[model samples]
Structures are given as structure tokens and as C-alpha cells.
Target: MEEFFNELFDYNFFCNKQLIEACSDLKEVPKESMRLFSHILNAHQIWNARINGLESEFGAWDEHPLKTWEEIHYENQRNTFEIITNTDDYETRIDYQNIEGRLFTNTIQDMLFHIINHSTHHRAQILADFRANGLEPVSLDYVFYKR
Candidate 1:
């Protein structure tokens, strides 16, 4: 499972870089798509920090909305790398609070999977947004990465 997650994370990071390269200009992307992408990246960082017992650099959504595509991409790559390098016991439980202040516990493996899945969901929306804006979206499927 760890190996699978690492591969997925690697593909995701590569695809994200491709998307950014495909975009002619960030200003052309829909605001909503940008916002959603930012949110997903921010959430990933916050959760990762919590799971690793590190202080969160940003507060909840209210405290910090991701401001730039560069910021999102940088953090996304950093976190993905961290996850791949992490070899701690996958079964170890991480306790963290959700945005609603609800306490929850999950294994490191689950958290990593969640991050990958979450990015996939939002990246789909971003592709749709690109098409709606009359822009061609990058091929970001796992198969595309494999090929």
C-alpha cells in the first residue's frame, strides 16, 4: 500500500506540473478552479503537518486562503516528497482535529491515500474548468502517466 501510494503521489506531482505547463497563463484559469486547487493543497499541508506533529504554517481556511498557483505547486511537491520518504509504521495512528473542531484518528497510510484521492477529485474539476474556458486541459490520468 505504501508503494502504491508513493507511485500515485509521483504521478500526481508530475501531472500537476504538466498542467501548469499547459496553461498559457494562470490569469486565464477560472477563479473557482484555482480556489479549489488551492484549498486541496492547503488541506493536504495542514493534515500532513498535524500527522507529523509539526506546527501548521497556515491556519484554517478562514485564516489563510492559498494566494498563488506557485505557492500551491511548491507546497504540493514538498508534501508529496515527504510522504514518499516517510517509512514510519503505516499502522501508527495520527490524531487530529478537523476544520469543524471534530477530533479524528487515522493511520498514516489512510491520510496519504486521502490526499491523493482528494487531489484527483479536484484536478478533474480543474480540467473541466479549462475546457469551459476554451483551453485544452492536460492528460492527467494515471494511465497517461504510465505511458
Candidate 2:
């Protein structure tokens, strides 16, 4: 389970890095793309904080500057890797509150999967926004990354 999650995180990291690199080359990122990507980074950090039992330094929809995206992404990845490495049981239930102040419990593995899946969901939105704004979107399919 740990190995599986590590692989997923690695893939997640790659996809985000690719997107960040793609955006860095642009003169100006589309507003929606920036909003979606910022949410991606913020949500990842928030999930990491929840798993680590620490207060999240970011909100789910917070907009970070373009220059800070890579740094926050790296920190989020590092924290997740540490959590994955140190976790003894992937099925261990975590109690956490959502952004809406609602309490919920989820297993470590489930939460980890959610983080990756959530990022993919928003990244697709950003890609679509890129295209709608006359910008080329980078290919971020998992198969492409694997190949």
C-alpha cells in the first residue's frame, strides 16, 4: 500500500510540475487557470496538514502567486511523502474537519487517493480553461507520464 501511494504521489508531483512549467512559459496565465491551479496547490497543502494533524496554512480556494506555486507544490509533496513513509497502517482512520466546518473520518489510503484524484479533477478544468483562452495545454494523462 505504501509503495502504491508513493507511486501515485510521484505521478501527481510530475503532473503538477509539468503544469507549472507550462504556465511559467506563458506571458500570462488565464484567470480561471490561475484560480484552479491555486486551488490545486492549496487543497494539496490542506490535505497534507490534515493528515499531519497540523493547522493548514492555506485555504481550499486561496490564490497564491504564480512564483509561489512550485514552492507550495514541493512542500505539499514532501509532506505527503513523509507521511506515506512514516505511516504504519494505510487503513488508519483520520478525523478531520472540512472547509465547511463539518467533521468526517476517512482512512489514510482513501484520503491519499482523494488528494491525487482531486488534483486531477481541477487540472482538467485548468486545461480546458487554457484551451478556451487560446493557450495550448500540456498533456497530463497518466499514460503519457508513464510512457
Candidate 3:
């Protein structure tokens, strides 16, 4: 599971960089796309922090604007790599509080999988925004990354 997540994180970072580079020259993109991408990263960070028993830096969704794209992507790469390298025991479980302050325990493996799946879902929306803005979207399918 750890190896699988490591590969997925690497693939995700590669694809994210490609998408950013592909749209580098675009004068404008839908603000919502940028917002959503940042939201994904922030959510991941918040969840990670919670699982690690650290205080979350981000408040409720209404409390902060999604971070800038460059910032989010940079931190995403950093955090994903940290997660891959620092986590060795897939069975290690952590207690976490949800948005509603409900507490539960989950394995590190499950949390890592959730982060990747969450990002994939939102990246599709970002791609749609690329097309809507007349920009060519990068191929971000997992199969494309695998091949």
C-alpha cells in the first residue's frame, strides 16, 4: 500500500506540473478552477495535520480563500513527498476529527488513499475549466500516467 501510494503521488505531481506548464501562457482561467485546486491541497493538509494530532492551520471553508495556484502546487508536492517518505507502517492508525468535530480512527493507508482520490476528482473539474477557457488540457488520466 505504501509503494502504491508513493507511485500515485509521483504520478500526481508529474501530471499537476504538466497541467500548470501547459497553461502557463493563458491570460486567464476560471477563478473557480484555481480555487478548487487550492481547496483540494488545503483539505489534504488539514486532514494530514488532524491525523498527526496537530492543530490545523486552516479554519472552516468560509474562513479562507483558496491559496494561489503556485503556492498550492508547491506545497502539494512537498507534503505528498513527506507523506510518502515518512510513512512506513501502513497499519498505523491515527485518530482524527472530521469537519463536524466527530472523531474516528483510520489507518494511514486509508487516509493516504483518500487524499489521492480526492485530488483526482477535483483535477477533472480543473480540466473542464481549462477547456471552457479555450486552453488545451493536459492528459491526466491515471492510465496515461502509468503508461
Off by over 4 Å in 2: none
Most lDDT-accurate candidate: 2
lDDT of 1: 0.72
Task: Give all TM-scores, in the order shown.
Answer: 0.82, 0.98, 0.80
Clashing pairs in 3: none
Candidate order (TM-score): 2, 1, 3
On the 0 to 100 scale, the lDDT of residue 61 in model 1 is 49
lDDT, residue 84, model 3:
67
Q: Summarize candidate 3's per-residue lDDT along 1-147 as a digit string, tens digits.
A: 657877888877777676666556556656766666666767777766765678877653422233355566677568766776887787889988888989899888888788778878888988888888877777887788778
**Per-residue error at 111 for model 1, in Å?**
0.2
**On residues 1-147, what C-alpha lDDT tens digit does candidate 1 reach at each position?**
667777877887887677656653565557666666666667777877877777766554422333455566678667766765775677788898887789899988788888878878888988998888877777887788888
Better of 1 and 3 by TM-score: 1
Each prediction's Cα lDDT score? 0.72, 0.93, 0.72
